[model samples]
Target chain A: MAAAVETASHIRAARRGSIRGSRRKALFWSYFFLVLFVVIFLAPPFYMLITSLKSSGEISAQVNPWWVFHPTLENYLGLLTEPNFVTFFRNSAVVSLCVVAISMLISVPAAFALARMKFWGSATLATGVFLTYLIPESLLFIPFFRIFAFLRDITGIEFLNHWWVLIIVYPTLSVPFCTWILISYFASIPKELDEAALIDGAGYIQMLTKIFIPVALPGIIAATIFAFTVAWADFLYPLAFTTSADQLVLPVGIVTTLIKGDVYNWGQIMAGSLICAAPPLIIYAFLMDYYIAGLTAGATKG
Target chain B: MAEAVMSGVRAPAARRSSLRAIARRKPMIAFMMALPLILLILLLVVYPALYSIHLATLNRSMKRFVGFGNFLFLFKRDTFWMVVKQSVIFACTAVFFKTLIGIFLANFVHTIPTKGQRKWRGMLMVSWVIPTAISSITWFWLFDPSYSAFNWLLAKFFGTAPIPWLGEPLWARFCVILVNIWAGTPFFMIMYLAALKSVPEQLYEAAAIDGANWWQRLWYVTLPMMRNIISITVLFSLIVTFANFDIVRILTNGGPVDQTQIFATWAFQVGIQGNDIPLGASVSLFMFPILGVSAYFILRGVRRRSQEI
Candidate 1:
């Protein structure tokens, strides 16, 4: 009787183990779909890498169009060594860095005031600032062209096709959004910190420097990254404003120089693009969480 | 101890700490702190925007007021109507797909346990955080007629004829919209995911206990719960897609035959390319009313929901 009972129990355990194995297979299929989704989404950049690595002849001959052959570093080498590409990179770096510095200079204090001070029209002004983001860059270019022309004529200082032209243009894009983000972050800080600082006879400036700046460091970093990326990757403004190859940023630079008229130098074009995309890709790989936090803050608040 | 406590309260009360005293001292410092941003916005955004409007009304030479003549001329053009229709089509179709796919993906990803959440979330955000212009170029390459991997894959899998992804007008429009959707949907995915996480599991549990299936649970519990985020995201996406220029420009440069010309691209053509400043301003300014209405509803919806929550 004991032997029969033990055999029956073992059979039951075996059946249960197989059923559990099938359930695991179902979960695997579900994960497979998610993995496939990522591959499809990531195809363009991956394809870009392959194309950038191929030689011009291979790209043109179209032998197994998806595969890279005679893998060469020629295009990257050429791009990096080219004087014009170097100039474009330099100009982009300068514009992006300056925009970050200038944007922070303006946005931080404005955020402080809006968060702390009970000023007249402060709420109205905050809303107004966000509305500025709705205005497209396409609209701004024409008026900018005319205004710059007028400035050149009056002040005898030529602003068109110059790097400094971006210095003037970028703030229009960065300042409003940065201020809104900074304001939101500052407001979320506890009121007691400022009260304690005030009790210590710390002035507003002292409080901003001593209390707010260190606390809101992540928001500031996120804003800086934003300002940098906007100034770096902006295409329309550079396309319209800068006609000179020497003055162009990466986006307009690669398109105009490599793919002209009807002939696309696909290999070199892809190579130039990868170089241009490197910085932001690196920034993103490191700081993606902070970036998303900054972007969604407005939505959550609104 | 009682005497010391009384002395402390009396000593603190002996000094005047009036609101007027604080304001009198810190008003200058507050203004000083705020002065830079005020000046920057005034010079850059506020002044240029107003100046642009002023310049749009006046003649090209700015010597005389044209008095809506440029706007009138814009209305007279055949291309303007074509652009309007195309813009609506682009924004609506793109927003539709983005919201649909975004919500679907969010739901799919959410079915996984919390431990597996971060991996998928990171993958979804990859498309979003990459700079727009760079990714647009990558898409541009992928849609190239003679050498697109998308077509190559299609050929390999199905033995189909090569479709001119950007050569034909309708196909070109579809391609542009497809790329726009691809680039944009990740944004919606993240937003929906955040909203989905906030949805209490008890509602789903209660619904399931009452005999609701997956579809029913999604319809009743998920949809209603995510309504505010959905509406706001749709509105915001609509606005951005309408104003979008990069994807369209990079993909087809406004088309095989101006078939993909939305308002923003059309504005670029007429304003800067055609040297018709007033016309471009008028075209761009057309976006204002739609933007205003959407902004109103979105802000109101958010406020109402937040109060409820």
Candidate 2:
């Protein structure tokens, strides 16, 4: 009986050990892939950073490519101090800020109305807003170019090559998504809060400013972040409409100005790209929750 | 006392009547509130969309009527056929890889304890947060000849010859799609993770209690619960990916015999640069049918989602 008891305990111990061993093996594979994915996802930017730190002469030399033999910050300094680069930076900043403001101004109230108020065609209008967001820039740029010219002829607005022209055009991209996100956000707000305000004879504007806006603050921040990113990162419109260096945004500016006659000033080029990327990256780093909320809400919440 | 009572009764009734008036005028109020956004959309989105169709019908100079002529011209060209095939391939491949890898990564991330998930997700989304132009151009530099990091790494491990990453037609197309997958997959990961969270834990527990294995639980419970989100995300991604311009434009610009040309870049090349507006407009219109289908699905998904909530 003692031997049988001992044998039974041994078998149970072995079974538990095997289960633990299998879990360990599963965890090992999971981390292995996780590390591998981190490297793959991060390699390009990491490489870009290393490349940016290397001097041009070092880059072209037959030397170790991964590590910087001779590091320098000339690329960053040079690009930053350059006049055209400054202009591009300024244009991107201005356009992004104004677009954020415009998108919020337009979307917040519209979303509130759609979410809270009962009106004819509201549902259809909501769908329309979504569909408009889906209409890609590629489809619009062509007609937009032609229309800009037509407007130039009729309205005397020199929109074809102006930096300010982007302000008018970018709302098309930002407003629909902003409105959609805001609508979902507004709808999700507890109806009781706003309903109580309504019962107290509060005006819609008062209810919006005093109640809905404060409650839906996270949603508003997400929308603003989204609009800012969209406007700042827009490459095609800047590339198409703005021909002169002075009018270019950072993306178009770097690509066009840095590459000159078959030679890529790669150090400076990578530096410019990284510099342009820093704003959004920094924003993402700090406000990741809001950013992710916006991204997922922009798609799934709708 | 009587006067005070009369005043009190009159005040509440008067306030109630005013509230009624406000509610009655809510339609006009809503309409007025929505007016600026409506006008903005009507001007920018609606007008331009209709204008694009009209532009497609016009000749290059915008003076002549050529209904269906430009589109017919496109149908006859070998390049147009290639563009159509290539666009479909690019969008479909990118979307497929993104969705698959996204689910995998999302599942992996989901497996971790909640505290670790955010850190891992932030790291993964690095590519997505960076502007596409910057990242795509970064890939362009990485894939540059004479010192391609990828080729060097490939040679190190696989002992292969230098890859013409953006030089060869097949590799160029593959590179573009790979970049799209890289940048796009994180979005799917986050969205899928959100969708996955909505799946009730009890379902999985019940499935396990019933002898359903890991795969079975995922297939029956997780996927079915996530169907709405999956469809919506894929549909939205399809539209975006189909109309994707930044990756192809920055990476190859439809070079190496225009092998990676999609509608956006092709339209830019032919219409804006080549000064053939009609052809460009016609090229861009090819995207509408596909997008229309995707949008329809997305709207349906949104409606269903809102209804559920």
Candidate 3:
């Protein structure tokens, strides 16, 4: 009996050891592939930084493109001082801010109504908002282009080729998604808090401002980040609508003005691209949790 | 005693009337709140979408109505068919690889200790966080024919000749799709990771006890649990990838004899740049059928998920 019990216990211990051994092996491979993917994923931006630091002459000389042996800050200095680059930066900032403001102003109230109040067609309207969010800007830009031209012809308002026009166009892209996101957020808030606020004689607008907005601040931040990113990163609208160098936003400006036809200025171009990419990247870095939460919420919590 | 009874009855009646008034006022207030959103959608999204159809029916000069003329023109052209083929291929290939890579990376990230996952995830997501236009420019530089970094490394390590990345049609298409995969895979990774986290660990343990291997566990356990999210993510990525413009525009511009032209770029080329608005509108409208179908699936998926919850 004692010998049999010893054998059984020894067998159990061996099994446990093998299981742990397999787990360790799995973990080692996981980290191995994770490091591999991370390198591949980050290569471009890393390359951009590397290239941006090199002078034009060094870039042209082709002395090991991977490393910048004699790195220079001329590309950064040049773009910073360049009026066109500054104008592009300013235009992108203004457009992004205005779009975010407009998106919030429109989406918050709409989301509140749809999520809380049972109005006529509110459910269908909410679904409609989601469907509209799926409509790519590529599909709409053509008609928008013609419409702006038609308006220009009829009212002489000069709607085309101006950066401010982007402020108007961008909300159409942002508001629907923002409203959809906020509706889900507002819907997730428990029913009791709003009921208590209503019992306290809070008006519809007052309840929305005092109760819903603060509680859903994370959602609001996520939505704002999304709106700002959409506005800032938009290439099609700004590319198609605004063509003048002075009126162009960062993405379009950097691409069109910096390249200057086949004579690609790699240093300044990379520098400009890096600068253009900064705001969204910084926002993502800080508010990553909110951003990821918002992203998953769209699919999982819908 | 008569005064007390009368006052109590009057108070109940007054409270009922106020409640009814609040109920009556709710719809109007809701309408007022939703008015801006409604107007924006009606005037901007719905109107332009329908207007594009009407615009497609018009002649290039807009003086005459030529129903289906532009589409007929497109049907007769090889480039139009090429655009359709390339667009489908690009969307399909990119989404497939993205989904595969995403699931693998998500599983990898999931296997690691929770403490280290955040750092790894953040690092992996840098490619996606950068704007596509900016990143595509970097890619374009990397694929530059004369001074290609990829080729430089290839020559140093493997003694390979410089590749004509964008100068050749096939390579251009490959480069565009590769850049897209690079930019988009991180999104799939993040989404799948979230889904992975939600999957109950007990299910995997059960599979392991039943003598399921790693692949079997993934096949039987992980994929089944993540089916809804996978479909949703794939569908979403499909729509976006099909309509992608920036990568193609900045990287190749549908160049090397227009071999890399997708619907978006082709539309831009024909409509905006080519000075044929009707033709461009028609080209863009081709995206509608696919987009509409995917959008339908997404709506259904969202509704079902919401219902399930």
Candidate 4:
């Protein structure tokens, strides 16, 4: 009996040891692949930084493209001082900010009503909102272009070529998604808190401001980040709508102005691209948790 | 005392009437709250979507109705068919690889210690956070035939010849799809990671107790648990990828004999740049059927998931 018991214990110990061994192997492989992916993923941006640091002459020279020998900030300074680049930056900022504000104003109240208030067709309306998000901006830009022209013909408002047209156009891109995110978020807020507020005679608007908004602040932040990113990063709308250098947003402006008719300005382009990419990247770095939460919530929670 | 009694009687009646009025007005109030959203959707999304269909029916100059004429014209054109074929290939290939890579990376990230996962995830997510337009510019420069950085690296280390990345048709298609995968995988990874975390740990522990190997556990436990998320992400990615514009437009501009033209770019080329608004509208409208089908599945999934919750 004693010998048998000892053998069983030894077997269990061996199994545990093998398990540990496999786990360690798994971990090692995980880290190896993780590092590899990170490198591949980061290579372009890293290359961008490397290229942005090099001078035009160095960029042209047949040497290691990855390494910058005589690093310079001339690209950065040139873009910053250039009026077109500055205008592009300003236009992007204004458009994105305005879109974010409009999106919130439109989506928040709508989300609240859909999530909490059982209005007529609220459920169908809620589903409609999600379905609307599935519609890509590429599909809409064509009609919008013509519509602007039609409007200009009728009202004499030059809606097609102006930067401000983007502020109107971008919300259609943003509102649906924002409303969807906020719906799920506001839905997730428990019934009791709102019930108590209702019992206390708080108005719908008051309850939203005091209760739901505060509780769902993280979701709000996430939605805001998404809105801002969409507005700031959108290429199609700006590319199609606003053509002139002064009216162009960052993405369109950088591509059109910096490329400049077959003579690709690599140094200045990289610098401008990097600078254009900064706001969204910076926002992501700071609010990554909210951003990820918002992203996952779309599929998982919704 | 008589005046106080009269006032008290009126107060209850007034309060009760107000309560009833509020109950009656609740739907109106909700409608009022959602009015801006309703109007925006009606005027912007729904109106433009329907307007595109009407626009597609018209002639280039918007004077004549040519129902199915544009589509018939597209049917005859080799480039239109190529756009369809390329769009399918591009969307399917990119989404497939993205889902595969996303799942693998999610699993790998999940294997690491909890403390280290955030750092790894953050680093991996950088590619996605950078705007596609800007990232595509970097990719364009990287793929420049004369000074392709990737070619230089390969030539330096592996003694390979420089590649005509955007100069050749097949290579341009590959480059555009590759960039799409790079830009998109992080989103899939992040989504799958969240799904992975939500899977109950006990299922894996139980599987281990059953003497199931790691692959069995992953196939049985992990994949099954993540089915809903996988489907949703894939479907969503499909729609986005099918309609993708920035990478292709910026990287190749449907060049190398227009081999890389997808619907969005082709639509832009035909409708806007080519100065045929009706045809462009028709080209873009081709995206609707596929988008509609996918959007249907997605809605059903979301509805089911919401119900389950």
Which residue pairs does candidate 4 place in steric collision?
Answer: none
Question: lDDT per residue, candidate 4, A1-302, as tens digits?
Answer: 99999999998888778777878988999999998999999999999999999999999999999989999999999999999999999999999999999999999999888877766677778778888899999999999999999999999989988999999999998999998888878877877776567667777789899999999999999999999999999999999998988999999998888888888889999999999888988998899999788877777665
lDDT of 4 by residue, B1-309 (tens): 111111111222235555555556678988998999999999999999999999999988899998988989889999989999999999999999999999999999999999999999999999999999999999999998899899999999999999999999989999999999999999999989999999999998788667677689889999998888889899999999999999999999999889999999999999999999999999999999989999988877766765655
Lowest-sum lDDT 10-residue window in model 1 chain B: B1-10
Position A60, candidate 2: lDDT = 89
Docking class of 1: acceptable
Judging by DockQ, tell me the better candidate of 2 and 3: 3
Worst 10 residues of 3 chain B by lDDT: B1-10
Total residue pair clashes for candidate 3 = 0
List residue ranges in candidate 1 displaced over 4 A: A1-33, B1-20, B59-63, B305-309
Each candidate's fnat, in order?
A: 0.38, 0.59, 0.68, 0.69
lDDT of 2 by residue, B17-107 (tens): 6566676777787888888888998999999999899989988887899999999999999999999999999999999999998988887
Q: Candidate 3: deviation at residue B87, Å?
A: 0.6
The order of the candidates by lDDT, greatest first, is 4, 3, 2, 1
TM-score of each: 0.90, 0.93, 0.96, 0.96
Stretches of candidate 2 off by over 4 Å are: A1-25, B1-15, B209-213
Report lDDT (Cα) of residue A134, candidate 3. 93
lDDT of 3 by residue, A215-273 (tens): 99988999999999999999999999998999999999988999998688989999999
Better of 1 and 2 by lDDT: 2
